[model samples]
Target: MNGNDQVSRCGYVAIVGRPNVGKSTLLNRILGQKISITSKKPQTTRHQVLGIHTEGATQAIYVDTPGIHLAQGDRNKAINRYMNDAATSALRDVDLVVFIVDRTKWTEEDELVFQRIEHLKVPVILALNKVDWLDDKAELLPFIQKLAARRDFAEVIPISAIQGDQVSVLEQAVAQRLPESIHYFPDDQVTDRSQRFLAAELVREKIMRSLGNELPYQTTVEIEQFKYQGKTLHIHALILVEREGQKKIIIGEKGERIRQIGRDARVDMQDAFESKVMLNLWVKVKRGWSDDDRALKSLGFDDLG
Candidate 1:
């Protein structure tokens, strides 16, 4: 053992909520960097993106999974599987479940989140996010009362996740539940994903923000290469599309849209990598990629993987 190493407090924390509830946004804020893909559209996140945070003696491993929704096609089925796995897997040994929800209203999905994980036998903190959207206290009070009646979560804290209002309060609430275990990650570890994964996720977030529905669901970001030069980082990436039409749409008139996307994505990737990046971006068609087992597996979206 080192000369000075106290017994660490390490445990997992899963963020579960409905689609478009700003789950990815919350994780990115906590990490002070982007690890999960964020979009205004529903169902943008596809898998459990792990983010590691260490504070004093506590190490909270956050698992940001896809939104919980009813299953439909194979893609939807896969997303459901990912959400269930992320929530319950950590429930087995985790110290907390942050049941995130919108503050303005409570929906069936929110109820489902409580019902699904109520048996975890650990603390379930009902984090009422997006309070900034609520203009009146009366509008949020009933929702909080409803959540309290559920008897499903341990504590309900109102917070504006995007604006970061009362986030410190929520953090303190979560930290209070952590057991005195050893730290699972190093002190400086901000997230569990590598640089390449974060680069791809940045690209994906750019596509979702720039292209909207036209190409958001049909796309996947893959980092083909990441290398270091003297002062700049050399990177190669592929924007996987399922159709030729989507590719053309992404490229846009005279490749203007692609250039815009590249600029935006490169800026974010550079900030994430902390180096000037020479990014090479290419768009390719994978033909119904989300449903194709091989393509999904290749992109690390498979159930087994």
Candidate 2:
């Protein structure tokens, strides 16, 4: 059949919820790849990452957004505001929204998410993630019943994104609702971001995983150079921090910690890109840059005001 005669499904799908609810994990599960970074820290995702999945006749472009949360306390920083706005913006012009939540765990931020999407005309599918960890499975039904009364959801699916449970069902549900249109991307393509962007994120992911409390949040990764020659790639990255003390924490005694971070990140980069990698890392202090809007824009967070 020709393009006009064949019925093809394609559209954007926004996955949103409060922090630490496994929004990024759900996206990685659906795509069967780690396109977005995940961490135990709330607000690990500072930008809206796009992951596209195509099956037989359906294409679902998933937008993995920063968790929507109440902006207060230390979370009231400029970067936090930028993350909130980016997540909110992903809701616009989408075919469907996958509202992910933790199983039987509802917080004030969940209520905030409800309020954000209450007036939207789009269809929402409530995904209760991490059901595998639920101690009492019998409570699932009652919880769904109570949540159902709060909003008119298209479907309420209980899933475990980390364990790869019921994610296919969620994928099928999203695919069925998408409109008939040509695919916006090639079928082989999985994400809208380039390798350089993903590389920087991978480095930052290592920073988040390695550092002690609060140190990672004060840091951002920037790729000074990335070049490929023959079968190997060379990368030079800088970790930007707000204070000299934070820089010292990252570098560690005798530069052991930063070296370990670079080693781990390079291994991950090799696996993700399927090539040998040479990663060089440096830590620098940019004093109070996270709060400075102009500085944030220079660091590639120009999407928000």
Choose the strongest candidate by lDDT. Answer: 2
Best by the TM-score measure: 2
lDDT of 2 by residue, 161-231 (tens): 99989899999899989999888999999998889999999989988888758555878989999999888
Q: Please give each candidate's TM-score.
A: 0.91, 0.96
lDDT of 2: 0.89
In candidate 2, residue 70 scores what lDDT?
Answer: 86
Q: In model 2, where do residues sit more than 4 Å from their true spots? A: 1-6
Pairs of residues at least 3 apart in sequence or in different chains that clash in candidate 2: none
Model 1, span 32-78: residue lDDT tens: 77788787887788777778877777678887877776556644644
